[model samples]
Target: MNNTKDFAKSSWIALVLIVLLNSCGSAVKSTPPPLRSQAEVVSVGQDKVEDSVEKKLENVKIGDAQAYYYYQLAVLSLASGNIEEAVDSFYNAIKLDDKSPFLHTELGKALARKGDLSKAKEACEKALGLDPSYLPARTLLAAVYSGLNEKEEAIKEYEKIIELNPREVQPYILLASLYKERKEYDKALGVLNRWIGRHQNSEVGFYHMGQIYLEMKDYEQAARSFEKAIEENGDFIQGYSALGALYENQKQYQKAAETYERALKVLGDDPRVLDRLLRIYTQLKDYNKALAYAEKLKDMSPEDEEIDVDIGVIYYESKQYGEAEKLFRGYLDEHPENIEVRAYLAATLEENQKYDEALKEWEKVLEQDPKSFDTRIRIGMLLSEQGKHDQAIKMFEKTLELFPDRIRSYILLGASYNQAKRYEEGLQVLQKGLAVNEKDPALLATLNFHIGVSLERLGRFEEALTTFKKVVELDDKHSNAHNYIGYMLAEKGIRLDEALVEIQKALELEPDNGAYIDSLGWVYYQKGMIDEAIRELERAVSLIDDDPVIHEHLGDAYTKKGLFQKAVSAYEKSMKLKPENEEQVQKKLEEARVKLKSQITTHTTGR
Candidate 1:
């Protein structure tokens, strides 16, 4: 075993932090035979004992001295943890001196170690009958009763020990532990409180009380108890740990941070304490503080992957995306098999708008774990935003295959199809979504709106209008339903007044919506309120300068008002911007040319 004194000298703080205190009022030392009590001297006369035994055996050894030899054998074997050999020796001893309580108790312990509980109990009872004051026999008997799940008998034996020796802390500690384990919390607290009163100076009592209070969720009391424990024994690292944890559980981050910071002061440079401080800083959203502590811990324990991840998290949470990505990448370079960190790095890249780089990272994650539904879903969402709807759809479908119960994937795929203008396909996807959750107003509205758009594309205005009405019914404030249905009606020059109402309602819900404003202007134009149409269209055009449809409406309104020069200007602007609509642009350009020619011809004839 490593030298405990050397380990303690190297890091005294680590010694205190690692010394797990038992309820029995003793600290576990960093040595072999872990938490056992100080060794009791079973015998101290090895030379004298050997000489006396040899002298006693001289005459019998030449012929037979089985019982005497077995007694000696049992003592040697028991010391070596050789339970079988000790049992054999104890059997021989018992055959010679059947009333020997010590031999019977030794046999009982060996039987218990060998998992012969019934036989062990019999041996303990026999030892107790021989000598009722044998503490080891009684203790072992209690263990036997416990193993048999005879709780009353176990408690009686433990109580008897307590009555016999009230000053000895083991029985009280053991009894309190049993009560705590059974979740008879009040009873456990009572026993522990009595123990503290008896051993008032012992930090063990206060520490155990704090643990019980913590389990009871009385954080305030637990913290106070821990503080008292620390006050009594400043070297009690566990007191500081529990106090810090109490503050953290209350979400009093500043207090938690302060408590953890204090723990560091008490237990200096402990890696576990430093790691906890890092988390406390994170909870406070003070990532810079977290990073500062994390760097220290990383230097202390360079190979700790969890600390590396913590540093990466601090950077990510602070919005230092580039630095976070670099850390994660470096970590993955060494821990290439760490799928979680790889995935996080990919997410960070995506957040930075580095789509291509992000995709590479994501692909690596998928290579390692092809069945990751979450990663597949993220890939789909990213591709959809980049306008690669086909690839996005495939990714979403794959995610659904992995997690068929994921409702959001279906919703996303439907929206992606709609963005691609495959309205029929979009409607089909949304219909399936509705089947999954029919009463979901948002999903119903989506399905109806897409169905309406599909019908509108096919020039079935009546069917489209009915579908749009259903969408509005499902979600009275569905913005797209109002705009699409209203715009279609305005374009057809039917229900122009009703179309204006729907468009106005849409604009009310989304006042900054240029599309709804354009719809309102178009309705006014269809109703032949040319001046009103000009004002609204000009506002819509200003708000949505890149919308070809708004520019087209503005140009047409100008043409209708006999502002031929302005009309030509608006049409030219629209034509330049809407280069994809070659047929419409050509028609608008011809109309502007005709208007310009008519104005010139009239001016010349008048002159």
Candidate 2:
């Protein structure tokens, strides 16, 4: 409903009546108010709000012309969002008509909006004084008391409101909300129970009750209440929303997805529910369902251009970066002001290996939102990926300068320094990060692990081992630290037995980790168990066929077993996989070939 126009038109009757009564000139013709104005085309706009103001407007009657005119202006100003002017008009209307409770209540509302809680309280009190049973005044007074942190007063007002009119559902809901806030769970439930008994199809009470149970950690009761909420009112989207959120919080993703789909069965693919479903599916990595929902949402809400961004994100997550990039670019062409979609485009470009294009987009994003922490991190990481270690280090330093409290920035800057082989700087940076989040074990483990890496690269073996041990102590489940400790022990080859135990423990932590498996194979090889080493290394190779280190380990095992032909094949495969020590691999390949030829000659001669 056009509330401003309707209220303004409603006052026309009083205006004409006053003008005709006190006219100083010839009489003017007056038309009667119609039962249905032209604006009553259909049901009012319930697409957003639940109720229409038409019902409330029926009681609005003004006898004074000047007061009525000021009242009309105030309502019009309120709708136009001119709060100051509306407040002034409301004040003028109240002065001209002090007995009208509606005027006082409206003034109180306007004052509350202006953050003048004291005066608002006074106005609401004045309205209640004029009419003891004025429910609007009581409601406004309750809200004002709540705003002033006078909870007991607010509770009294809501209770009196319910006592005055028990059939009114709003007072019950508001009163229950007050009880819920005070953690009076039983009282809140009792109020809601009364509310449910009094009002038909009032799912809101049950939904609020579900929230209360959820907050109290009563999962069983919460689920039942949510179910009852949805069952009570088929159109209550909040009920389904609460159910979906509850299931997700419990990690019952399948049930959450089912609840989201059930909303469609009742609401027929409401855009709000579909949007939630699209996000939930995306989070679950169910790309097929996510894409399908995105398409349906697009078709349903063609005017919601932001749906294009959602579709692009789905394509991006599914690793169809080409499609994502195309879609994002198309959207940006029409709406270049969309910085968020441009960020998606940058990510897609990075995935597609269009580094230069990605860099440009990141630069544009940084220009638009200079304080975006993640964008700064991404730009630095991209620079590091391109081997521009100095530039990456500088970018990360700037990020640290801007956001000193962000622990991740310190980690990133440290990583860049470590990549540049500046071990001291990397160590110092990690230590700085450790100073703050000293109590967060996960963060400590991360910083200590990176520090350990820097120490290992600096040839500080014993210190690095000690740091890794510290990391394990901080977080025993940290598989990376376990693998590092095991790999380092195996490489030293002094404590072969201890190395074997460590590597086995690492494999126990992450059974499918190819690097840990390779460490195990290396431990076996150092112990002269060539056959065992070969088996483990071959398994590691199968697990991570692209790893050069695993292939090289298999080659070494084959050489130890004197299977020169197989050894030659393994070394050639290692070389093909691009081992870092290419020259060493080439020398090993030559030696393996010579050994194979010698073996072949000896076998033939012996035959």
Candidate 3:
């Protein structure tokens, strides 16, 4: 055995964040165990070791004196987690007092704790033979059987325990849990129902039933049972949390928040309840409440630096990018090597349009976690966002090379090629993605959409239209495909009525989409609805003012209405924005200027 001095140096536990294993991957509240210094534990443990053996008094009728001494040492060993020594001492105690059922049961418990289940079962059986109604021995035997995966024997023992002690809570709970583990939900429910029949107001039993129903995916029954449990006990924390979680799973944030609030009303500032409120409020975009809970939790556990990351995330989600940036920087100052916090800082900087600074942060994260696929993807996206399409394409192609099974890299690289107008390369990559993701309707739709765009830019109009139609067949609500088809037909001045219908459908799906609105305006212009064309085109410009194409469309609409001065102004604005067809736009601008001059001259002569 190691010296007690070593034991005195390794007892204190450390605290850290508990990242939830939820879809959101959000950090939730966690607290550390109360600090126990090795010195304190050793000091207390030394006393326990020294004084555990009882003094054999004068005629006290204590079972064999040596057995009592060994029993005390066994208990002390067990408490100190010295399982092997505890088992040895327990067996020693039992050998001295062969008929003592308590000693036999204690030995069984030690064996069970040491994971020697077969021996533990034998010892427990010996104890039960000494006293047939010995509850502790029977309980140990049942647990040993369970540990050995002998569910049927465990169930029989539990049934005997329930028959022997019908009013006890644990036997029923244990039996139902065994059945639940085996997915025998009906059996689990039966055990709970049997308990509820005898003890109608058993909140715990009802809660167990609700848990079983939840596993069965009988959500309505789960809710009813949970509600019933809460009605039976207003202070049932488990009931409130479970019901709130159910509502959250259903995306009913308001009702979930209300249930958590009710829990808080009854249970005060319980950490579990507080943490859940933080998550719920964050999801609801109730940043104020989320921050309040975060601050409160920080106050409760000042030593934990993990909460700062979560608080920073809350700010990021709230779109207070400046505040989020500041928080992340401050956290990184203390935890300079924390890749996760640095990544957040990068994202915050990106959202604030500080692209260069964001790139530096992402570079730092990538250097720290070189193999991180997500980090690599983010860096590639940042490059693309800055119109460094070739660099982005190279990065994504490398990502595909490094992680060939990653479908996202193929999609992103294909999109990057299309953005760079490398249409043939984009088509090839997109087709490869489709080949690999044949069964994924959603990915197939996305890849087909990109292929259609490439074909459209390549002037393969019929192929592009067919591909776009295929995207809509895969996903009827694909607004991009609808808009593409509409704009293609309108651009060709053919099927104006069908173009209007397609654009209107796209607008129906995404009413505020500036691109779709511009498509609608162009379709209207094709149909000779010049006034309506101007209205929709102007609305598109208002929504996305930097779009040179929308400006050019507006200029065309003005010229068609013979508003020569307005047409000249719109064309000049389009020229300033550096439209794709610069020479064509310059020609339009010159023509509009000549028309404006002629109109002024005609008006003056008429005056």
Best by TM-score: 3
Off by over 4 Å in 1: 1-86, 93-102, 214-224, 246-252, 303-306, 435-607
Worst 10 residues of 2 by lDDT: 41-50
Candidate 3, residues 405-482: lDDT per residue as tens digits? 666777888889988889899989877876573577777788889989989999999999999999999998999999
Off by over 4 Å in 3: 1-62, 76-96, 182-187, 197-201
Per-prediction count of colliding residue pairs?
Answer: 0, 0, 0
What's the TM-score of each model vs. the native?
Answer: 0.67, 0.75, 0.84
Deviation in Å, model 2, residue 181 alpha carbon: 4.0
The CA lDDT of each predicted structure is 0.74, 0.80, 0.81
| Residue 568 error, candidate 2, Å | 2.6
lDDT of 1 by residue, 313-350 (tens): 88888888988888898888898999989988998999
For model 2, what is the alpha-carbon lDDT of residue 178?
Answer: 73
Clash pairs for candidate 1: none
Candidate topping lDDT: 3
Q: After superposition, which runs of candidate 2 have C-alpha atoms over 4 Å from their true positions?
A: 1-164, 198-204, 214-220, 245-253, 370-372, 386-394, 397-410, 417-439, 543-549, 573-587
RMSD of each: 10.1, 9.5, 8.4
